[model samples]
Target: MGLLRLGAAGVVLGLASMPTFGQRASAVQLPTYSYFTVGTSVSVPDRGGAWLDGVDRAGSGVQSFGSARLLGGTRAFGTGRSAAGVGITATIHDFEALEAGLVDRRVRSTNAAPAGNDAWTARLDEARVSRAGRGVPSVAAINAELGLAEQAADQEAAGWLQRGRQAEEAGKPNVAKIYYGMAARRATGSQRREILARIAGLQPSPEAGQDAKTSETRR
Candidate 1:
């Protein structure tokens, strides 16, 4: 994967990388942001470009967006891809140094239960893990702290969208789907619709495909 300089705004704990594949990612150095920016693996053509994984591939973009909440500030997920310019997104969860850089450095100013807007600042410590998190237990908090009840869902969705797109580019559609699924959960309004559509565009399971064919035959 090329460097993941590209970023979209979101509300979540401090941005940092997460380790994918139970290990740290290569040191390609994705850009740092005060908000969480998920990490992705940077890969090169394996020796002599012979490795199947090294080949660069392109993926489809989101033509639709979420329709949840219906908040005004919510921007279309990738409605204006041309304006945003194509950039890499975090694909795999295997980010390097995440365990050491972020999870290990957590600190809490107080013993509060971590509610309200303050939760949005939980701390990704995000190398996707560098945020020295605010001492909230479990990854589920990343959800509430990301301000789930509020309108920041689109912001959070964008980050996930980028990851799915980048994963697709890396010729990893299954991985992309994982991130896209995550985005789908958080996305609202047009963003959600588009992401769902994008997921549909990907290949379906054999059971689902057979069902579709059966339904078509019945029709």
Candidate 2:
């Protein structure tokens, strides 16, 4: 991946370098307000094709705030319909990093539940061992990982839209509205319109209906 620059709006903008098999790139800084995030994107061209894109973010303290697979693009290298294929994957994690403190040396657990304390400690030990295999963890390093995770998650518009649909089907309109709003923020064209319409449907008021009509007119 190329060097990432921060825009005036604090968005991380960068181009990913073409990737080869068994290749790894360093993490790039991502924009965040309250915490830190970092990300890496790779495209590996192999038998058919494979790609991995991920971002990580730190929580308020020692937990994972969230982690997501933001984007994946692949192309097949064969002939006819069977010759080529393309696929994409996107994911998001909210309230992530519950075990982040266990992995990072800088974070010390304080308010954990008593019942799971022992299990948590064991997990922390495992994390410590894993970290040792890589290297000592530092605040800067952890923040970079989180930034990457956040960046990856931020790119997952479809994931958010799906979540909205799931919440709506579950009869949780309020929750669905939140997810739809997130999806609409990143969606475009018909997809965005569909998400916005779902959101409007959740609001039960004549004014909301009028507002929707006005929005449609403007669009």
Candidate 3:
């Protein structure tokens, strides 16, 4: 009878522990941010010729996306690439050091998200020129070469357009007009015209129509 009693106590204890075990497992499974360090790695092939003193490989570019953690930690993920030749090369870098770098980083400080407009503009221009430098290549090849970078630029423009539309919808005509003008400058042709029309329709007056002309001038 005592043994049975002990067995019953053991069963109760095991059942009591189950919730704690589950809670611990749940904590472990929770998503959290991490920091990382990224660097470039290059591979060169020896062609053994005048143009090929060493392996002719392109310099690496750094690109990554990451999030912040609750416990003053950051989680970052990165992918890098460099291609000078015909083959597509890619690298994924993971590290803890990135979190260390952003340990005390603020979310929206003026220093944190400070205007990257100039940088984006320069990058877009570079992509355009780089495409042109390819010497009259087919659109497919040009798109393949410049698409990712150019698309990033367009995405920024699209984001501006969305914000402008939101502002216009909120009846903030002046701010909407400014943002729409900016978006038109960033986008091209149909996209520009579409945003202009939306802005014009929002204000619905000679002044709003004038906004479209302003957008055209900026473009």
Candidate 4:
């Protein structure tokens, strides 16, 4: 699946905590509530192509980023097993190719700039979801009950860079400088270099006179 998605809350407590294979003393396997998982397999065709493939049991959430080679449209098949304990499972997918397309409506509406009013927000939301939903599994069940969503670690870093751009465009050099510094840490090599260049341009250089004075003082 491409960038498998996650849905809301699900518990994945360890089976060890429960009665073992031999002890027949009355013990219950804690009822696990399932959440929605978004996945992509080659099997989904046409409209279903936008859907994901996977089963999420109660109280369990999934979050991962990874790539899946489509076997055939609407015919690909794969398997995943639930762990015996309480935790989330994730698989990494290549997000670079998909970045231009996916956008969570909820995220955009909740966090986009004001200039991108509700109308603009809706447009951007649609664009992102359309891209992200591709090959994503259905997590409605998980989200409706639990409330988990698949998230990316680098997502926050991208946000910071965006904010920095906004600050820079608004003529807030000091604020932009701080943001650029942050972006340099989170960004890739090329992006980091660009951010550093921007920051260097905005900063004032030390005066030669001050340098000489400092040297004399030290002597």
Whose lDDT is greatest here? Answer: 3
TM-score of each: 0.27, 0.24, 0.29, 0.23
List residue ranges in candidate 3 displaced over 4 A.
1-141, 204-219
Off by over 4 Å in 4: 1-154, 203-219
Q: Write the per-residue lDDT of candidate 1 for residues 10-101, one digit (tens) a residue.
A: 22211321211123223232342222222223322111111111112233333222232333112222211111111233334424335636
lDDT by residue for model 2 (53-120), tens: 23233333222211223233332222211122223344444343435545563433433323455887
| Models ranked on lDDT | 3, 2, 1, 4
Predicted candidate 4 versus true structure: per-residue lDDT over 1-219, tens digit per residue: 333322211122223323333233332344444444332222111112222233333233333222223211122233344632122233334354357345565567655544645787777766765756466556887575443222342455567678878976776655666666665656665666787788788743233223223311110
Model 3 lDDT per residue over 129-208, tens place: 45465667689986887878667668878998988878767766666766776677668768888987876776433553
Query: Model 1's lDDT to the true fold?
Result: 0.49
lDDT for predicted candidate 4 compared with the true structure = 0.47
Q: Residue 32, candidate 1: how far off, in angstroms?
A: 56
User: lDDT of all predictions, in order shown?
Assistant: 0.49, 0.50, 0.52, 0.47
Q: In angstroms, what RMSD does candidate 3 have relative to the true structure?
A: 30.4
Q: What's the true lDDT of residue 206 in model 1?
A: 45
Model 4 CA RMSD to the hidden true structure, in angstroms: 33.6
lDDT of 3: 0.52
